[model samples]
Structure formats: structure tokens, C-alpha cells
Target: MNDFTPSRRSFLAGSAAAGASLVIGLNAKGALAAGHDGALVPNPFVKIAPDGTVTVIIKHFEMGQGTTTGLATLVAEEMDADWDALQIEFAPADASKYANTLFGMQGTGGSTAMANSYMQYRQAGAAARAMLMEAASLEWAVRASEITIDKGVVRHGDVSAGFGELVGKVKETAEPPSEPILKEPKDFKLIGQDLLPRKDTPAKTDGTAIFAMDVAPEGAIYAVMARAPRFGGTVASLDDSAALEVPGVSAVKETPKGVVVYATDTWAAMQGRDALSIEWDFSNAEGRSTEEMEAEYAAALDGDGPVARDDAGVAEALETGTAVEAEFDFPFLAHAPMETMNCVVQAKDGKVHIWDGSQFPTVTQMAVGAVTGVGPENTSIETVYAGGSFGRRANMDSDYHVEAAMAAIALGTDQPVKLVWTREDDVRGGYYRPMVKHRVKMAVGADGKLAAWQSDVASKSIFTGTPMEEMIVHDGVDHSTVEGVSDTQYAIPAMKVSVRNMETPVPVLWWRSVGHSHSGYAMEVAMDMAAEAAGADPVAFREELLAGSPRLLGVLKLAAEKAGWGNDLPDGWGRGVAVHPSFNSYVAQVAEVSTDADGRVKLERIVAAVDCGVAVNPDVIRAQVEGAIGYGLSHAMRQKITLDSGEVVQSNFPDYEPLRINDMPKIEVHIVASAEAPTGIGEPGLPPAAPAVANAIFAATGKRIMRLPMVDAGVEFA
Candidate 1:
């Protein structure tokens, strides 16, 4: 055997205890976590047990996105371990080791889970495999270079042993290589395979998956909050005598956000909250209706605000050419995640423990710690499975979590409080996708070529008062406000894109694809209009402008070919195509629609093509694309969060309905295969769905519906 000596990692030197397991972390200088059975406590990503179970610690949240399965594939592929013997768990809130490299924070959003952790998990798995091979080399008196691991078994010629058998000696004699070699794409066994089922699917299917609502501690109490009816409204007076008299009610406490009612269970707490009476003060609240807000936004577009992108000679060029003007008004949209917002908070002995399906755990920990007088380091967070977030749970204010912590503090911190928001609360809740208005004026020269393009966008900034403002906002212009327009890959010459950030008392958040959600719609619809003005086919016009973006063009061509863009459909049906790139992924979708005599649109079918660089899990990518199309179509067809006299108009799904089962069209997703690094797939599929459907409606009927929730524009779905 070769005498191999490894330089001990400083972080793991004195922390290692005599044990029969190995733990490898993503960072060489990370802190030690408490390990099971006095094993090496250092590192936080990969752990090998004495029983041969390879546990991968996932730092991202999985909300029906298959993040767990995608992340675990990296480790299993590099370690050459048996996929069936592997398990996964969520990492605790520790930014030092678990921070996303893209955001410098421990959070999951923007579909950046796989993009950020791909190399980290691979390195972790390689390090563990290196240590195991060295351990087996020493135990069997074989050369480390000659030992090979295949499907969880270590072998040297005829001598063979399982990873569990050699793990006991890894900590005693073997050392992890500082730079472990990784497998190439050609040698990968599980990275691109679709047969390896998702690890979380079985639990979710068998009713064994534990969501935030399933958490029940021994002395846990249920809490429900009754907040003001309007955004920025405050509690002026409160009477809790009737609430206290309700059955199973224990106490009602008033906090800054709202009044919290604690009871023995969820039903009792909801009943108690309903029984309480509170007078709201709307002196500084938002009293403008949707129409008033729309008017103000429309007025803001009349003048230019902060410049996101300014090109010279655009004004002089527009003086002589024909201008095609288009305007769009989008209403505030609710996330309306299925589970609502719920969390379990426990505070005792000046420390706090929070349990939730946290999309932003670091922010939640800091917010809860500040509320309970506990430092962030002392606050512990346990992330569970989320039903759905879409962008609701990752609040900068940590709204629901902070409320739960305050309730625990007010109720004497002896018991845990499980705070739940009813569907009504969720519908009326503040943080919504901001209402936006876009005005695009394109000047075409006599030669039928695009000469000048000026786009003015107005919307409430989602990052103005949040922690992300400093990173995302630039030069007094929130980059998110003009993302899709300012960063368009279309070859438009002499373009000027400006953004006007409007002030609003109502809170706004980053919906699925952030700014691309509305910007993509405005840009795509305007492109279609410009194509008509130029007397060219929509697909041909896009092809002429998209020469600079190969990925975008690739998907557009693929989608058009798959959908038979130029082929004649049924006599009444018309087709439209839209392409958008968001979160580093490019997606194109084509919709087939037929309009009734009254201009009601009936979506016949949809075909989507996505180029997300590399497909980590093809199944997951296809599923996400399908879901995104459905979600996007649902809002575009008939969903809006309107406001009247400062009160939200829609209370439940009836008014703001999701797409009915029978309403969903047949969807087909095609993925482009490439050798580049993998990108996000969760959100890119959404930006094109709405615009494609809108364009299809226009194609079927010669009328253009510029506003959102087409029903309001007198364009209903049959």
C-alpha cells in the first residue's frame, strides 16, 4: 500500500471524534454540525452512515419542483453509489455553508436551486468517495489508485467490500483529498437518466410527506390572525370579550400586524378570531380602486422617468416613420398558494425554534430572532415540505413567521404556536404581484424595417424597501421593472427603455418569473403587432430579429416546427407563437385557439419547447413546463386581484378561479439537449404562455385585447 498522508482540513481537525462514518461538507472552512452517534461533526452536505445509507443534505426548498431529486442526483452520480440506498434531507438555516452562490444567502427561488448547487454537491460526493477509497486501500493492503467503487461497493481485484464496511476505518486512517476528481458527462450513470424516480414522490403519494400543517408538537397551540381589511390600515379599537367566550378559545393578543387568537386547535382559533371585533383605521390606507390606480399608471407613462437603457438618435428617427402604438394594463395578482402561509414557532429560554416550508429561511430566522430578542445564531429553523409558494413564502418582512413568533412571546413562550392563515386571509393578504402598465411605440421605416423602439414601463418596485434592493436596484432604476424589455435579445436598433416606479401603500412581491411575468407579455404582444404592421409572418419577424440569441432562436424554431406553425388548422382555429428567456432558461410556446361568435377564446392545444442548457431531470423539466403553462393561462383567462375602496374584491377561488380541469388544453413539452451547464426550468415556461394565448386570440379574431384577465376586456373563454 502507498503511504498517503492528507493535510487535515482546519475546520475538521479537532472536531472529529472516533466514529464509524464519514461526513463531507461543501466548504473546506465550514462549521461543524452535531452529528449522529459522535461521528465526525464537521461539514453539512454529505454523510455516510455505518449502514451504507448516503444521506445528501439539500439546501434548496422543494415545492413540487423535484429539487430534492435533482440535487441528490449530483452526489449519487459522482460518488458512484447505489441510487436506491440514498436519502435526502433539508439543511438547517446556516448561511456560512448553505448560502446560494448566486444570491449570497440561504434561500430557494428564481429556479436557482440546481444552477447554484450543481458543483457543490458534486465536489462533496467526490470528496466522500475519495476518503472511502483510501480507507479501503489501507484496510485491504491495496494501492489507493487501484481501488474502484461501483454501486456502493469498493473493490481491488478480487477483494471487495461495501461502503458501510470501509466507512468505519475512513475516519481512523484515511483523509479526504483536497481536490477530488469529478466524472465527465460521458461517464455519468445517473445525472441524465429519467428512470431514477424522485425520492420525495413516494412519500408525497403515500400521505407520509410532512408539510407545515402536519407539524404537531406535544404542547402546541393553534393561532389565527384577524388583520385590517385594507392595506396600510391599522387597528383602532378592539373588543375580545366575545372571542374569549368562544369554545376552546384561550387568549387573544394584539400585535402590530393584526390580532392573534390562540385556541386548542385550528378550527377553534379561526372561530375565536371571527368572534372578535376590531375597528380599522384607514386614514393612511390605499383607498383607490383598480380603475383609479390604472388611470394613475397610465398617466405616469405619458412622461419618461429613470432611464434603464438609452440609445441616441431614436427621437430623430421616429419623426419620419410610421409608429405602431400598443398599450397594456395588468392588475395586481395574488400568489394564492394552496397551503396559505403557516408556521410553527417555539420560544423558550431566550432561544427560538421555527418550523415552516421556508423558501427564505435566513430572512425568516433574522426576522423571528429580532422579534423574540434572540440572535440569529441562536434561532433554529427546520424546513419542511411546502404545498406551494410561487413567491409568497419568501417575504422580505417574513410576515406570517414574525406574527407566529410574536404570538408565542405574548402567550408566555411556554408552548409552541402553530399560526395558520385561512384562505380569506391569503386572498386579502398584501404582498401581490405589482400592477404594471407598458406602452410600446415602434417606428418602422418605409423599407419595412424597424427603425426606432421606445418602451415606457410603470410599476411599483418590489425591492425598494427590501434587503434585495441594494443588489438588484441600480442608478435609481429597479432592474426588475424593465428586465424583459431592457435585456431583450431582439436586434432592435436605436431603442430606449425607461421605467417609472410608482409609490403604493399596497405591498408587492416577486411572482414566479418576477418582472418577466408582465414584461414578456407586453414585449411579445407588441412584437406581434409590429409583425402585422410590417406585413410579415409573426414567426418570420421573430426569426429576423433573434439572430443574436441562438438559444432563444433554437427554441422558437423547435416550437414552430413541432406545432406546424404554417400548416392549416381546423377552419375556426388560429395559432400564435411567443418566445421568452427568463432565469437563464429560454422557452417558446405556440397556442392554437378558436373564437366563438362573441369573441370568447377557446384554447385548443399548446406546444412548448424549452432550452434550459442541460436537463438535469427531463421528467421534472417537462412537468414544470406543463404546470407553468397551466398557471399562466389561468391568470390570463379570468383571474385578477382587484381592489375597490381599499378593500380586496376577490375573497376566494370562486372569483379568482384557477384553470378548471376541463379547461386545460393538451400540452406537449419538448426539451433541447445541450452540453452546457444546466439552468433553471421552473419559471421560464410561464412568461410565454399568456402572451401566446393572447396572440392566438388576436389571430382568431381581428380584435386585440390589450388588458389582462381578458374577461374584463370583453374577451371571455368559452
Candidate 2:
């Protein structure tokens, strides 16, 4: 038998002792979290057990972004570990154990998982590999440089030993080297491979993967709550006698936001919540509907706002030509992840334990601890796999998690409670992306070039009253509202951008692409309109204007070529295009659209080109591009969350719906080759999707879709 094959059966029988696992860190730059006693904590991300299994504990939560596979590939490539024997585990709640290398806190968001973990995880593998080689060197009594590893086997001349055999020797080593070697990308066997199926796919598909909602702790009780329909409204009074009388229904308590119904099971809790009668007091909130907000925003734009930027010579440029103006209106958006929002908390003996799929579990731990009076140090969070979370689970204040903890505290801590938000509740829930309106006036020179520009953005400040207020909000302006506009890609002689930060009772937050969700649509569609006004081809106009940005220009050319931008379409069909840069990645998209005999719009195809730098997994990249396309199209086509008389108007899927399969377009993704470090891939796909389709519609039928949910513009749906 070969040296490697003979150790297989023997390795399978060995197991690691609980205390023998090797613990190491990459560096002091947020890698090895120091404890209260200034001692090294045990956070073994790459652990080689005696049983020949390699376990990697990750800090970030995976919500369909393929971090599970992408991260595993990074470590395995560096360690030369056996891919078949690799396994993944979620890190437990301990700030000193698994802090994010970038944030110093145990949380995940901002598409920063791969960006931050890329070096740390790989270095961890290299350290482990070096430790194993040192063990093999001692056994063979040879220089460590003489030992080489291949497929989990360490070889020195005629002597050979598997990693499982050397792990015991590794345990005997006093300490690992502070600096370990990392592999060059050219030697990678798994990091860039797209065909390697993810390790979690089979379990997720076979229904064995346990999501947070699927978890059932011992003696768990179910909970359902009724939130005030109106923003800033409160429950004045509630009668829960009828709820208490129901079978399996145990108790009902009044939380700050609503009344929660606790029962023995989920069904009973839901039924009990339905039986309760509550009265809401919304005296302080009024005129919060979409119409009222639009009027307020328009007025704010007419007056002076907080000027974000102002360049000299704008007045002279405008004096040379009359102004061409355009306005774009955007409404509130809901995150609406498929699995909805749910949290399970156990508060007993002055300590709290939580099990949830939170993108920011550290925040959840801190929030629950504070609410339960247990202290952050006393709280423990067990992170579980999430179904999906665009950005809701990582709210600035952990709103949903705090509410769940409050309900659990009401249940006396001894009985664990699983607080759940139903589909209706989640849809009508607060924390939608703030409604916004953009107004821009431009002046062009005689040469058909942009001479002067002025832009005004008005919306509720996402950071004004949140925990991030002190850090982000400045001089009465929220930079997030005008990020894409203030940092316009096109060159102009004179430029100015301003924001009118308004206050509304409605809760708002950062959506999938945050500020770019609105700013990208406004800038892209506005550019298309400007091109048409100049009687120049949209592609040609943008190319000439964006000469300064080569990355964006390259994608524009590539996307146009792939989509046959200048080719004639079937009569009545039209093509539209848009390109944008956000989250340090550049993307360009072109959409082909046509109307059927019934005047219904049909999205035929979408061609997207991206430059996210060094593609980690081409399959995941394509999937994210396509998924974002669908998501953006759904919102632009019909999805909206409206309010009337201070109460939410939409209830469920039938009202606030997703794009059906038939409505989704055939998408082709092309990735530009480059050796640059990887940037974000999750949100950049969505920003340009709506504008590309909208611009195309304008090209086909001289109807400009200034407002979103093209339905509002009286456009018929396919």
C-alpha cells in the first residue's frame, strides 16, 4: 500500500482530546483577541484533530454568499489539507475568541467577510501547516527544511507520516511561530476553482442543515407579538383574557412597542396573538404617508440644504446655457428576507443565552444583555446559519433582537422564548429604506459637454438618530444620501451637491446597496436622459464623459459589446444601459426590453459585466450578479412599501410581491480579468439594474420612468 493510503483507516480511529487542540492566531492586528487578564485566548480557526479531520471555525455568518466554501478554500489551499476531510464550524459568542479582524468586534456585514478574512484565514492555515512540519521534523530527526507536505502527508526522504500521526507531536510543541509562510496564488489548487461544490450544499439541500428558526432549545416556549401599525405609535391598552383562555397559551406581557403573546408552541402563540385586542395611540405621528413626504421633500429641495460640495465657476458655466432639469423619486423599501426575523433567548440565573441567525451576533448579545439586566459579559450567543439577511439582522441598534429579549425577560428568564415575526408583520414592519427624492439641474456647453451641475437629495437621515450618528452624520448632512452623486464619475467644469436631511416618524435603514440603491438609479438614469437631450448615442455620450474612470469605462465597453448595444432589435424592442461604481467594485449592465401586444413590458435579457478584481469563485460571482439583477428588477417593477393615515398599507406577498419566475430576464454575466485584490460582490450588482431597464424603456417609448415601481408611471406589466 502507498504511504498515504495505509494511514487512512488508522487515522479514522483516532480522536482529539478536548484539551489537545492547537490554538494559534495570525497576528496582533485584531487577530489574537486579548482577554481581560491580558492572556491569549483559545481561538483555533484551523484545527487538525487526531482523527485526521480538519475543522475551521469562522466568525462571519453565511447567508447564501458562499463564505462557507470561499473561506474553506482559502485555508485548504495554504495548508495543502485534504479537501475531503475538511469541515466547518460556527464560532461561539466570545469577543476574545473570534473577533472580526477588521471591526475588533464579533460581527459581520458590509460585504467585509471575504475582504477581511482573506489574509487571516490563510495565515491560520500556513501556521498550522508549519506546526505539522515541525512535528514531522522531530520524529524523523531531520532538518525541518527537508520535510515536504503533500495531500496531508509529511515526507522526509524515505520516512513518511500523515498529519493525524503528527498531531500528537504538534500538541507537545511549546509554541507556534509568530510568522508562518503563505502560498502564492499561482500555486493555489482550490481558492479560484468554481466547480468545487460547497461543503454545506448537500446538507442544506437534504434538509439536514439547521437554521436558526429550526432550532428548538429544551423547554422552549413560542412567542408572537402585535406591533403598532403606525410609526411612533404605542399600544395604549391590550386585553389578553381571551388569549390566556386558549389552550397552550400561557402568558401575555406588554412590551414598549407592543403586546407579546407567549404560548407552549408556535401555533398557539400565533393564535393567541390573533385573539388579543389592543388599542394604539398615534397622536404624535401624522402626515407620514408617501404623498405628504414627497411634498415635504420637494419643498426642502427648493430651499438651501446642507451643501456637501461646491466647486467654483459653476455660475459662469450656467450663465453660458439654460438649465436642463430632472427629478427622481424613490420610495421606502423593505428587506423582506424569505425566512423573516426570529430570535430565541433564554434568560435564567442572571445570565442570558441566545440562539439566532443574526448578522451581528455581538450586537445581539450586548442588546439582549442590557435589556435583561444581565450585563454584556454575562451573555452568550450561539450563532446559527441564517436563511437570508440583506441587512436587516444587523440593524444599528439590534431592534428586533432587543424586542425579543424584552419579551423573554417578561417570561421570567426560566422559560426560554422564541420570538417570531410573521410574514404580515415583517412586511408592514418599520425600518424600511427611507423614501428619497433627487433633483438635479444641469447646463451643457456648446461642445455638448457637461458644463455645470447641481444636485439636491432630500430624505430621512439613516444615521441622524441611530447609534452611528456621532460617527457618520456631519454638519447637518447625511453623506450616504448623495454618495454616488457627490462622487460623480463624469467630469464637469462646475459641480455642487447638497442634501436636505428630513425627520419623519417612520423608521429607516440601509438596504441592500444602502445609499447607492437610490443614488445609483438617479445618477445612471439622469446620465441617460442627458445623453438623449444632447442627441448623442447613450453609450457614446457616457464613454466621452467617463474618460477619467478607466475601470468603469472598460465595463461599459465590455457590456455593450456583449449585449450588441448598437445592433438593431426586433421592431418595437429597445435597449438601455447603465454603469456604476460602489463598494470599490465597478459594474455595468444593459437590459433589453419590449412590449407585447397588450402594452405590457417584457424584460427579455440582461447583460452584466463586472470588475470585482481576482474572482474567487466564478459560479458564486455569476449567481450573485444574477440574484441582484432579479432583486433590483423586482423592486423597480412592482415592490413598494407605502403608508396611509400613519399605518402601513401592504400586508403580505400578494401585496408586496417578488418578481415571478416569468418576469426574471435571461442574464449573462462577464467578468473582466485582472490581478487586483477582491472587492465587494454582494451589493454592487443591484444598483445599476433598475436604471438600465428604465433607461431602455425610455429609449423604446419616449416615456421616462422618473419615479420607481414603473407601475406608478402607468406602465403595464407583463
lDDT of 1 by residue, 478-515 (tens): 99999889989899988999988998789899998989
Per-residue lDDT of candidate 2, residues 1-718 (tens digit):
0001112222112111211222344334434333222322213676676666777787777888788877787778877888877888888776565666555456777667777777777777887787778777777789998888877788988888887777666533235556678888788787777677786798899999888899898899889888888877778888999999999999999877578898889899999988999888888765467788789899999898888889998778777765678898888889888888888888888888888886876556666666777866788888888988888887756777777788887666687789888888888874788899999878877777777888889998987765456556778878778888888788877888999988888878888888999899988888877776677899999999889999999999999999999999997788999999988889999999998787678999999999988777778888888988898988999988887877889988899888999999999999988678788888889999999999888877778888888898788878
Error of 2 at 43 (Å): 5.4
Q: What is the alpha-carbon lDDT for the whole of candidate 1?
A: 0.84
* Steric clash pairs (candidate 2): none
Pairs with steric clashes in candidate 1: none
RMSD of each: 6.7, 8.7
Best lDDT goes to which candidate? 1
Candidate 1 residue spans exceeding 4 A from truth: 1-35, 38-42, 596-599
**Which regions of candidate 2 are displaced past 4 Å?**
1-43
Q: Report the lDDT of model 1 for residue 134.
A: 76
**Model 2 local distance difference test score:** 0.79
